[model samples]
Target: MIRARHAGVAAGAAVLLLLTACGSHGDNTQSPAPASSTDLTHLQKLVEDAESAASSAESDMARE
Candidate 1:
């Protein structure tokens, strides 16, 4: 059950990363900055969110 929740969060992060990458390609406003740096920020935030989710999942599991 824990693994399943983690997997879902991982998958969501992957999809978000892909979407962010795709959206950035067409924007020239931030073209000066490389995608790697921009994506890194997004990735970091996603990681933080994932951790929070895992914590929440753990709490929920405990209740169950």
Candidate 2:
């Protein structure tokens, strides 16, 4: 399980790396900054919602 999880993560990272290395030939003058606190906060909210959904699903399954 651990190996599978690691492999999955590695595969995702490889994809991201490939995309980054093969940059677009267009102008990047309007690109957003790499890191932003607002983005982090939004991601945190998304994670919370996902966890809540998972918990709700588990409870639903338990009652079935």
Candidate 3:
């Protein structure tokens, strides 16, 4: 029937509208600057220390 066809069209339009509304509202804001050289070096040192600790732990576990 014509009414049923119109109802289907209206339902489809509602779904489309809901989907568009739910789409991401991404901001155009700029990200912060990259880390400075000093900060990067500190981070590198921390990572190295963590890796060394992990290796020591594994070695101890193997000995046990």
Candidate 4:
């Protein structure tokens, strides 16, 4: 009975140690910079151009 209790405690301790080692704390080290106003403007232009081209292609296909 005593040996069984020791084995249980050892197993529990091993599990706790493994869990603590695998946990992640918040990572501020590699966080992305917030997009600047210039970046947003460039992205908006790119998206608009892509959508316009897609619409033109779809319109051309519909005419065919």
Candidate 5:
């Protein structure tokens, strides 16, 4: 029937759109940036502060 043909064509177009949505276009501009020295220093300071806070909490918990 003509209705069935139209339904099939709609379904095919939907599937093709879905496939292209998920397919990679082989673009080289998606690479991640390298972390700078300042970034590393900031992250290291954050970890140190977290560790210091954890140690302080443990000390407080010990007195409870």
Candidate 6:
């Protein structure tokens, strides 16, 4: 009976340790940088140019 009680206490302690190990203790409250209108416009232009270049490359590869 005492052995069983000891085993049960050990099992409970193991479970508590596992739960504490799995918990996130770091600060994750940082906010993201807000994007401005000009930044969005620039990013959009860059994406458009990249897409145009990719399409041209694909067409050239098909012709080869």
- For model 6, the superposed segments whose C-alpha errors exceed 4 Å read 1-29
lDDT of 2 by residue, 1-64 (tens): 4344444555555555445445454676455335355655655565565555556666666787
The residue-level lDDT of candidate 5 at 8 comes to 55
Which candidate number maximizes TM-score?
Answer: 3
**lDDT, candidate 5, 1-64, per-residue tens:** 4344444555555554444445454566464444556755655565565555556666666787
Off by over 4 Å in 2: 1-34
lDDT agreement with native, every candidate:
0.73, 0.54, 0.53, 0.53, 0.54, 0.54
Task: Give one digit per residue, the lDDT tens place, for model 4 in 1-64.
Answer: 4344444555555554444444444685354445556755655565565555556666666787
The per-prediction CA RMSD against the true structure, in angstroms, equals 5.5, 8.6, 23.6, 24.3, 22.4, 24.1
lDDT for residue 21 in candidate 5, whole number 0-100 = 42
lDDT of 3 by residue, 1-64 (tens): 4344444555555554444435444586354444556755655565565555556666666787
Q: Is candidate 1 or candidate 3 better by TM-score?
A: 3
TM-score versus the correct structure, for each prediction: 0.49, 0.48, 0.52, 0.51, 0.50, 0.51
Local error of candidate 6 at residue 12 (angstroms): 50
Quality of model 1 by C-alpha lDDT:
0.73
Model 2, position 36, has a per-residue lDDT of 51
> Which run of 10 residues does model 5 get worst, by summed lDDT?
16-25
Best by lDDT: 1
The residue ranges of model 5 lying beyond 4 angstroms of the native Cα positions read 1-31
Model 6, 9-53: lDDT tens digits are 555555544444355445783544455567556555655655555
The number of clashing residue pairs in each candidate reads: 0, 0, 0, 0, 0, 0
Give a tens-digit lDDT track for model 1, residues 8-64.
897788787776665544455655334577677978788788878888888888898
User: What TM-score does candidate 3 reach?
Assistant: 0.52
Model 1 misplacement above 4 A? 1-3, 11-35
Cα error, candidate 4, residue 59 (Å): 0.1
